[model samples]
Target chain A: MAEPVHEIEVEIKNVEGLHMRPAMQFVDLAGKFDSDIHVSNEEQSVDAKSIMQMTMLAATCGTKLRIKAEGADAAEAISALQELVEVKMFDETPGK
Target chain B: MEIKKGIAVSPGVAIARAMVIDSKDYRIPRRSILSSERTKEIGRVREAFDNAVAELTELEKDVAAGESQIKDIFAVHIRYLHDASFGKRITDFIENELVTAEYAVSTILREIASHFAGIDDEYISERAADIYDIERRLLTQLLGDVRRGVEHLTEEVVIVAHDLTPTQTAGFNKTFVRGFATEAGGRTSHTAIVARSLGIPAVVALEDVTASITSDSLVIIDGNRGVVIIDPDDDKMAEYEKFSRELTEFEVSLGSLRDKPAVTRDGEEIQLLGNIEFPDEAIMTKDKGGVGIGLYRTEFLYLYGGSEPTEQDHYEAYTEVAHHFEGQPVVIRTMDLGGDKLPYAGRQAPETNPVLGLRSIRYCLQHLSMFKTQLRAILRASVLGDIRVMFPLISNLQELRQAKMILRDVMEDLDEYAVPYNPNIKVGIMVETPSAALTASLLAADCDFFSIGTNDLIQYTLAVDRANEHVVTLYSAADPAIFVLMRSVIHDANKARIDLSVCGEVASEPEYIMLLLGMGVRTLSLAPPMIPEIKQIVRSVTIKECNHLARKVATMDSQRQIKNYLRDAATRILPEAF
Candidate 1:
């Protein structure tokens, strides 16, 4: 059986760039799906579910990210992560 | 007499014996564990990790709910402890490489931190600090016997440290630790905030305080001026001793004046009030027999809490202090901010000569909306207790009229909105500038009361920047020029039939009490700790004698002559005080 793979690209928009807080949120979201999620910049890729690996990517504001998910839940994982990066989860003020 | 300067984080002057606190002395042993002791070494590492996690969890819970940032920092520390990669790396070094748990942990963390330090992104690189912090905590746990902190002080001493962690600062012993000076910290650092909340004098950001100050050497922490003096000569020591004795003796004798009224022997009553920066300080005011709050510094509302406070914030703060007074006048000064006290750079325009430029009343006038918000809040707070709205640094009648007009506008808006407020809140002005002092009669005609701000008045009158050490010697409140100005202002206030008070450092000393009393300042407001001493002097002197002393000093031509005369008069009247 072939595993399904879903992929998407997101540009960082936060004023402080892709800092610890955003990376933490991204990892937390990745942990929710039963997929092997990988986030990457142009030069490097890392496991999205690993905080240390995600931090090692060192992405900043305006940096483009390519997210790939591979599993039965790959589509859902990719969609949720795309939405998180687009809406800038953990960046915007709460209740706004 | 080598003096070092840092940011003054807390107030008050403390002179005590110095003690060095160097947490770096907690060294870790570098030895390989034998294969036979592998199980024990593994157990030791596991125990260290378990204890570290438990301590962090306890620390997270112990932190106040408002300090969420600190809680988050502790959370990161816990995460590092639970990190599988970090644990595997350390365990591999201990089991396969034959190294001690302490050495393995430190070496692995150091390598990881150095790797992070090479990251181009600042946010990613700063994670190196987090790694270092976690490394130190784990090392401390692994080498338990070598732990060092302020927890072991046995006697009162001034702590000189590289820096203090929030946990260590929180556990400071007030009885054994007179004060603390640190090599790193800004005014808003956790150590500074905790030191201030504890009412302990602290000077931070002194780059080499710990290295320069030796243990058991006499040291002075002038938190008020942000200056630290180490190993003073005999002359300087004697001077500081006399100054310390006056404050200590005054505090000790305060108990006697608890039941006594602040009245002259000639039966003239005087109001002795406290100058407070925070609402909680009102408790000290009431404890020290302060009849009212003469100067409620409102600038702290902006400086503290990490943001510009809203109208609701000001209202709540003013209401809390007002409630403490129980109808006694709580004179709230509108934001006397600028110069070195500017909180945000973008909010205020930068100036070359901040002291002589946009500051205090000038700043309030320039920023009318901000000023009106404070006025509206103050008006709303007046219903809770007796609230007097006082403006600071009003050098001209126009500034007063403009400020009063804005207050009127705020009151009208509140009325239109059907909001409740006190309509007849007493309005007042601080006589801080020479121009303000000269025009005291005109200001008194418009204001309901007057409070002389001798600190600024002395600086402005002598054309001296009080903070500039080169010219600070010339800045004297006891100057003959100040005496002349005080006499004129008192005469004007008397003619205008408005209440006048002295609310400055000058009013705190017993020597200046008689001179101010002679100058017809019937009310005195100072730091809460100085109230009892001033009250004692107020109770002992006759109004006639004070008047004579004032008259004699007013004619003196020099600061020395005036100071000597006042000292002689103070000794004669209060022999026990000398």
Candidate 2:
């Protein structure tokens, strides 16, 4: 049986948006999970665990992103990645 | 020698060896590796990654320990290094394209960085610099060649760059970076503002500053002239060397003039006083050849101190300044607040018309207790030395009399305590407004002397709100209307036999000093640094020449003509200062 896939839609909340520094933090965090994580903007989808690919998304402030995760820990990946995009805003400066 | 002319954004001259920085691609020539060397290329790529990551981690550690704000930025760079795909992409390129490790790293990183640069969003586009920075680091390790940025500069040098972003310019160590010349940026660019605020000499928009200068090139950044000379010839070098020496010698000579009197060649004595805000500036005034304090602004005490200043706070500052020139007059101008500057603690309701609102003496009269606190301090410090009181923005005789009554009330209260004070401290009014200047003869009877505050006098007489940029152009010190008011005020003071001095922006300016002297005005209270240069002008010319110039200026109808004539006249006398 294949591992289940879970996904959630979240908004980039930080004013700096998904720039290099925040994107790097997201990819670094994704690399720690036991799942394959991918993030997609309206134009394209890319591996969330790849900083190079994540930067290609070019998601600015308020850009909506759909995060999808697949593995035995897919649920955890979905929630953590969603929290990063929505709650933590990848820990970038706010009101910038 | 090659001379490049550019817009001078900041003023000063700097001579130093050039330090070139190219922010773009390293321009590594493309070279192919033998297919057999694929393994070696991949190994080189892997090792470079490891080394770069180690270097970044070490920097991040030091930044973390040193309490730097950039530690998070370094962490991001480290994350890029540790990204699995980052290492794989370069290696994959090296293997597939049969290219050298350096070439593969440069091309792959350039591809990523260019994507960022191509983005339309400004914040997103700026990430391109970081990608370039990371690529430079990796290439530095791969090619075993050291990269030089302004941060790595250990010796004094003039930075020559194609373009410097605001971020890069802000990080420069001012001690080692004496000056800079760039190919891009206008006078009002963020880079120029930063350069000016940092007090560094910068000339931007040179177009070829970076291309013409090399690491070994000796460059002269003459920001005053907006000229950058690269590898100057022997003759040009000697000229600049003499210029550099003369500049230093001029500074020393200005200092030596502190002892010289502010008297003209015809034996006419001119009283040169200093305008100050704090006590320390009194000492600087004396050092700069000022005979006394002309306008001792007391608002700084109320504005800077967290709360309302105690009487002691006011007394201490006055005593320190008054003792600096024991016998000379120290005119303490009462708090001139609520115009453009308001007390920081009170976020007062925004007035529809701030300049016309209650300010200076008007504000003091409304807040009588605050007024009395400052008066008691002034009266108390007066006994310590020759301290005189002055009121600012006195528009009419009624306000002057009201301020005098309060001063008398405070003096009486001091007498109740048997305080040792100057029972007869002389009082004066700043003839700054049209009402005061127009009615100077009437107000002179109530005060001991008059000080023409030309800044506001010009503003009020011209009906030009100087703080507004649109009308500020019309606010001219050399305006025929302003000179008319000045003539009236000076004539009245002479007739009344009361001392008069000019304590405003006009006094510090060299172009107006001769005119002030020519107008039969013997006293000038100006910025301390201006004392020596103004004295130089006084000593070089006679009162007769000044009168002749002033007469010519009076005949001029237009402000532009008067200003040009004054600048020409002053510059002719002291060409070096102009």
Top model number, DockQ: 2
Chain A TM-scores for all candidates read 0.90, 0.91
Candidate 1 residue-wise lDDT, B110-205, digit = tens: 887887889776766887888788788777786552223345667678877767654354345556788778876655444555455445778987
- What DockQ does candidate 1 have relative to the true complex? 0.19
Q: What value does the interface RMSD of model 1 take?
A: 2.3
Q: Return the lDDT, model 2, position B218.
A: 88
Clashing pairs in 1: none
Fnat of each candidate: 0.18, 0.70
How far residue B165's Cα lies from its native spot in candidate 1, in Å, is: 19
Q: Residue B445 lDDT in model 2?
A: 91
What does candidate 2's lDDT look like per residue over A15-77, in tens digits? Answer: 877887788778878888888888888788898888788987888887888999989899987
**Per model, how many backbone clashes are there?**
0, 0
**Clash pairs detected, candidate 2:** none
Per-residue lDDT over B200-260 for candidate 2, one digit per residue giving the tens place of the 0 to 100 score: 5778778556656533678998866778999899999898888878876875887888898
